[model samples]
Target chain A: MRETGRPLLAWVGLAARLVTGIVWIVAGGLKITQPDASINAVRAYQLLPSSVAEVVGIALPATELVVGLALVLGVFTRGAAVMSAVLFAAFIVGISSVWARGIEIDCGCFGGGGTKAGAASAYPWEIARDTALLAASLLVASLRRTRLSLDSLLFATRPAERAATEGAMT
Target chain B: MSSNSKASARAQKAAEMRAAQNKREARRRILTIAGVLGVMVLIVGGSIGVSLLNKEDVKAAGAGSSEYGVTIGESDAPHSVVIYEDFLCPYCGQLERATRKDLARLAADGKVFVEYRPFDLLSSIADYPIRATNAFAVVLEKSGPDVAKKFHDLLYENQPSEQDPGSMTDDDLVKLAVEAGATEGDVRADIEGLAQQAWVDKATQEAADSGVKSTPTILLDGKVFQDGRTIQDMADNLMAELE
Candidate 1:
């Protein structure tokens, strides 16, 4: 039971890592080439000051890509997952705030965020998707032992430690 | 008994050494993660700095003007209707087709201050929006708003689909401007030369700054138009409001 559960959890963590990582990569890729659109999207939210919004617009795409790379390669699984969770949480907050304030805005998750018509109706779905991503990020953060990952290769347990751990497990 | 005691002591020492090594490894991993996070922060900061430094300066003809918009009615009209539009947007085209005559009539009747804000929101997707906006800018600057309004309508009437926006070239824009009553000399040259490109860029940024997310965003009395989806519904609502 223990062996089966451990492998399954690791696989689940791996899946979570890939899912979140790929999404971040796609989102960042879509916005990275269109700086004006990114800035416009950030501006449409009207949450941040203009200067701060510009900075976020410039930095967010690169940050997403880097975090996604880290997660996909499983180089820093826990750290990447934490970053992912933070971004998702921020999106949820932004969407909720817009909904509360009765502002019509596209969440701009993948790209093209602006004051789209009928945008108010999409807030709930955006929040739900982000919430689900947040949950996946949390799962990846807690379950640090993922299979087929750079972490395993880079930080494998020493022989003596492995033997000790295996013996204890048995 | 003595040998057994020594073996157990050696085993305990080995366990202690292993624990210490594991602790060191854990600390090193944490430190490594911290270093990586620090690098990420630096990257973000550097990117922000670079973007700010490399930002384009807006130098449009209408950059610092108070009344840069194309006005269709008296300044002190009782009702104010502002329409933000992009030439490349299909929905904007539809909206214009639906309400162009009514808006003009209302403006002409001295009942409303109708303003048309033409910007190039889709410059990233296609070049036509900026080109068309630049042509309109020249018309507005040289030929005046009446001619520019005609040009605006002409562009919409000849609007190309998003997939084939390249069909409309500089020549086509100049021809349309001429057809709209602008002369075929300097005005045509200005349209071809993209004389007002910077102005279009500035206006686009201004639109984004003002939270004009999508094209055809209509504002009635300085508020987002929330009357209804259909054009007729919106017109009825605006008329009711004005009444």
Candidate 2:
């Protein structure tokens, strides 16, 4: 129980949660506004069949919204972290595939606005961003007891028991 | 008891307390994780269902009809001019008006063919059906180029304001086609058939494949004409290519 040593990890966790949560929520909210555009985006990927593409388009945005909400609230931080990591990895792969085929198109990940050139199309930067977030999430998952967490307060050890045992032995 | 023993006891109790706390924290973490995962599954699953249900709506709305397809121009013409246009795009309407006389002269000489592909430039702002394109496809399929040209003129002539929802009902489309010299039965039948709808979708895909990202994209002999130039300029370019 190296409590004193864990604060730095917790801070990192907080930062990761905030960044990922905000991004997901914004991206998801944008997609929700234009579901058809989202669907077109999925179709552009050409990975999935049309039937599957439609379903993926709708579900992906909603998942982003829910996971983002959970992360922002600091409830289920570990779960949201994992979800965000997986989703980012998938997007990286999708973007990379399109880039490999020489398709010069937006990833539509941040809602069709942030399109860069060259290796940016391959989305190496995006993959790096997601990987860093995944590392932070994994750290939070490993270090489950942060100061402001409900788990920390509810699960605090009984100091009184330690004092009583010490007195009896003395 | 010895003081050292007492200290040992305290240390053990403290360790036990910490272990218990850790255990409880671990349980809570696990439970919260499970709960969030459950919600994620539900939400993702629900969205998939909604998307499938909305598929019909998207198709009915003609989400994929603005792409390029067959030239759909006059069969006897030596050269073809493909025009990609959007009903909401003022530039396309302007081109229609500006080039109307030149196009008519070419068509009258039977020396040039014109093909129309619908582009949805304002889909971001409004939910208008890709119907303008679909209507063109239907008219072209049923009543040929003359009727399509007429319907095209009428659409551009009666173009609605950019802010308003500019869609034509089946009846409205049919009436326009009738005015354009299409038989009532042909207009009714072509509009009713989903085949025309499919044609629009395929045409749109083709347009996208051809790297058309904007409205009023005019291609002469398969090469995009960035500057349509004047009618004379276009004719000169065509004559140069032919020679």
Strongest candidate by TM-score:
1
Q: What is the lDDT of residue B220 in candidate 2?
A: 66
Per-residue lDDT tens digits of candidate 2, residues B1-243?
999999999999999998897787688657755775687678666655554554422111111123343334354677667677776665567677766666667756776666666755555555343666677777777777667778878878766545465454666767877888888886686665534667666766665665555556666655655332232344455445433
Error of 2 at A111 (Å): 2.9
Total clashes for model 1: 1
- For every model in order, the TM-score on chain A comes to 0.89, 0.75
> Per-residue CA lDDT of candidate 1, range A87-160, in tens?
99998998998899776777777877876545788889889988999999999998857876766654555665
Docking class of 2: incorrect
Predicted complexes: DockQ each? 0.12, 0.11
For candidate 2, the TM-score is: 0.46
Task: Score residue A35 of candidate 2 by CA lDDT.
Answer: 63
* Model 1, position A87: C-alpha lDDT score: 94
Q: For each candidate, C-alpha RMSD in Å?
A: 10.2, 14.3
Worst 10 residues of 2 chain B by lDDT: B56-65
